[model samples]
Target chain A: MKKDELKKKRIIWVIWLVILIISAYFVPFVLLRGINQVEASFLYWTVFAVAAILSTIKITTYWSD
Target chain B: MNSFYVYLALSIYVLIGFYIAYKSRQGMKQGVIEYFLDNRSTGGIVSALSYSATTYSAFMMIGLAGFTYSGGVGALGFELIYLAGLSLVAFFGPRFWLVGKKYGYVTPYEMLGDRFQNKWIAIISAGTACVFLIPYLSVQLMGIGYLMNGLSGGEIPYIVGVIIASILAISWAVIAGMRSVTWTDSLQSLIMIVVSVIILFYVIYTQLGGFVSFFGRLETEYSNFLSVPGPGFFNFQTFLGLTLPWFFFSISNPQVSQRLFIPKSLKAMKTMIKGFLIFGLVYTLVSVLWGFSAKLLFPGLQQADLATPTLLGSEHVPLLLGLIAMIGITAAAISTVDSIMLTLSSLIVRDLMQSRDEYSDKKQLRIGKFVIFIIAVIGIIFASQQLDLIATLSVTSSVGLMIVVPTIFGAFFWRGATAAGSLTSIILGAFTALYLQFGNLSPLGLAPGVWTLIITVVSFISVSLFTEAPKKKANEFLGYLDKELEDKNIL
Candidate 1:
């Protein structure tokens, strides 16, 4: 609940998001080449859905400070 | 393919639009701020819906669906990357809202101009927005025209559709400005989601017999439609090229970024962000599904843009549902066009005019309305040109607007960023993007978008490094923001 804590939390989220984005960009290509189309799409969507959910949580919690 | 049905549907939509416009005008005071931004009184739902509606134009159903149909799951990945890019919103939304509220900023460029302490920064940014967004708005109008004409089997002329779209766009914005646009956009967003959901269900259950069967068909019959480089389109580089500009869309696009200032409270803004993300996710899924369904039902369509229309007119889709889908597409295009028109008008009146003393609030509102009319007329003229695919035009506009990204980031985050750097980046970057696009030349096979972004960043940073920084003003602005964010507990 401290300002420093909140800043740290936000920083963590930012780092997570950057990692997620990079993965989202490249994972599909790797998946498509290595796996079946359905598997690749499913993996891609799962990652995207997780990212979307994390974003929603991050926005909703931003005001908690 | 009854022209009468299309006309009836459009008439009903127009009547509803007029009713919404009239209601939006109630209790509305006539002033520049009130007219342009609804006096910053917009609530969360309207903000979210307007943002979603404005962001997802007819491009989603028509262009994106077609992209998926031709380019495969890379379309979904491209759009998801865009959704992922909304992380920038989470970072910048609070900063924008606090600054706008504190400074009473009317347009996004106003914030930039004030932050940089250079009116030319504002003017140039506004000019860049106008140059790119006008063509973008024209594409929205063209989408409606093509949809109506295609649905009617050419019983209605494309020009008629263009005229109708122009009229609707003008009336919606001119009638009540942001209030009317936001209200109608809310309705349109709901219609867009609902209709797409219904159509998705119908396609999956009725036509394809369910999700498993749908996937089975995709795997067994159309496996190429589910991965990158499938059917030789949407290669990794091409997909990156197309999506790179869109990744920064929330900040680069003035219309959507301006909405960051509209929610009446931080809580409301939170609601808006969450709501829009949900809407975007579901709508995106529905659009991609529509594309996959089209691939299964109607294969070998010469034009990728024809995917949506062909699916809607196919034997499986009910005529009534198809008609409703047509309305939904029209709503998407009009909602987006009207928002762009309003934003452009604001940029012209507030940022470019520079002499606010010359015009009263009443006079400013009038000028804004007049600009909207002129923009609509110009958009109609451009739409009549019947440009290339909607997706291409839409991406080109985003790439063109991407030149402003460095300037915006500098305004918000970088103190060392100078006005000289911002201006140089925008001017040179915009020219580079335009030349590459027009000349059909991509350096080293990289997209114009990537090239523009790289050049713009290099110019922005290197110039700022060499130039003097606005230390005092930067401290004042950023200091105030830090204090406000802390005081408001908005971090």
Candidate 2:
């Protein structure tokens, strides 16, 4: 991969990560607050799952570089 | 519940560990660097496993579980944030590897010393690490002792457990240094992952019925446990306080950072990074689940730290599985403690004792072994004191070590970073962290960790601006590193 392309990919990944982090904090503290505990728990898990998936995807790019 | 079963299992495990240590001694030549760093020739899998074992300690099984049990899903978030912090590895790992291989630097402090052209930087960094890490090491030993005593139904005393752990931790490192420790850490990491996975599945299916039911129960019955400040223990500021330092743990902790030096090639280093991420994700999930499981089955426990022991001792858990869990936790603690002991010994022998060029590698090797023994003895003594919660003690050490992060980043990334700035930042930041921690002061509700980091960064940058920069040396080191990295197509 070209250095420019790699840098672009990294920048995109960082933006995705930041968005996920915001959503992770938002869901539990704001959006899901006062929601049913079970539903909120599931929402939190979904957020974590998404973050985990994102992390795995990021790590998979290691070999390409 | 018999102490005999616990002893029997542990004896077999220890014997196997000793065998691995003996095997690791086979191809090793006598020299300080080779013994301390496996001649910087560690392969991908062993490096990955050793890194995993070193990073995830008894704290995962015992301390983290308890943290989740009492603190709720916030614990999960805190830990995941730590996982996210590995992104820093993606940036720093290759840089460290190239520099280490190029300079033949064994200890992280050695890198700092050379980078800043100040021996005092190396001395202070090592000394700071020693001061904080000793308590951290003792906490791991204490975890083993407590787990053993708990698993044996009080038949085996905690002191005996401490002795057993102390012996294993010391013997493995002293036997063949990094070679033995790396091999054993690989084995132990496997055991930790496998045993934790098995137990997690068993509890989720047999005890909680399945994931759906488990989640259902937690949602309905323990809603408060699903969010921050659920029980008011993990308020936002407090959570940040607990996690901010750990967010920088990849660079701040020297044991893990030093492993960046050991992989044989860039490809091998990539393998190590990928392998550790996978291992870490699985282990972190299992550990968090252990805490959640404990909270579900045994509510109303007086102390959060009792979560693991209570859950394992419950009628639903099999006796054999409990014994395996005990061994897994012991392996986790010993894996971590042995690495810390080795790193500390290297810091003392290679960085400190050999500073004046008065010793041979042979003499250094002997001194390194002696230092390992001495550290183990000190750890045993400290563990016997049975200090505060394992999580608290571990985090305190981490927070103290956070003072180094700014200086380290400056050394690597910024050309203008000066020796005076680095030294002042570290000394002041370290003292401030310790003072705020021991004095129990947190200004503006921020953790001492966050404050110390702020102060350290400001001090480093400001002092560097006003002070002399090692322009020629910085350019030489960074310039060569850049050219080499580009040549190798690693950047």
Cα lDDT tens digits, model 1, B1-491, are 89999999889988998999889999998888788888888998899899999999999999889988888888888888898788788878888988898889999899988888889988988988887888888888877878888889999999999999999999999999999999999999999999999999998999898998998998888777676667768787788888889989998899999998888888778778888888998898899989989988888899988999999988889999999999999999999999999999999999999997588998888888899999988888778876664334555788988888998888777889998998899889988887888778888989898899999999999999999878888999889977766666554
Chain B TM-score against the true chain B, each candidate: 0.97, 0.98
In model 1, the runs with Cα more than 4 Å from the true position are: A1-3, B387-394
Q: Could you give candidate 2's per-residue lDDT for residues B192-248 as a string of tens digits? A: 999999999999999998999998898888778876667677777787787778878
As for model 2, its CA RMSD to the true structure in angstroms is: 2.4
| Highest lDDT model number | 1
For DockQ, the strongest prediction is 1
Alpha carbon lDDT at B350, candidate 2: 65
- Candidate 1 docks at the CAPRI level of acceptable
- TM-score per candidate: 0.97, 0.94
Worst lDDT run of 10 residues, candidate 2 chain B, spans B482-491
| Candidate lDDT (C-alpha), each | 0.86, 0.83
What lDDT score is found at residue A61 in candidate 1? 76
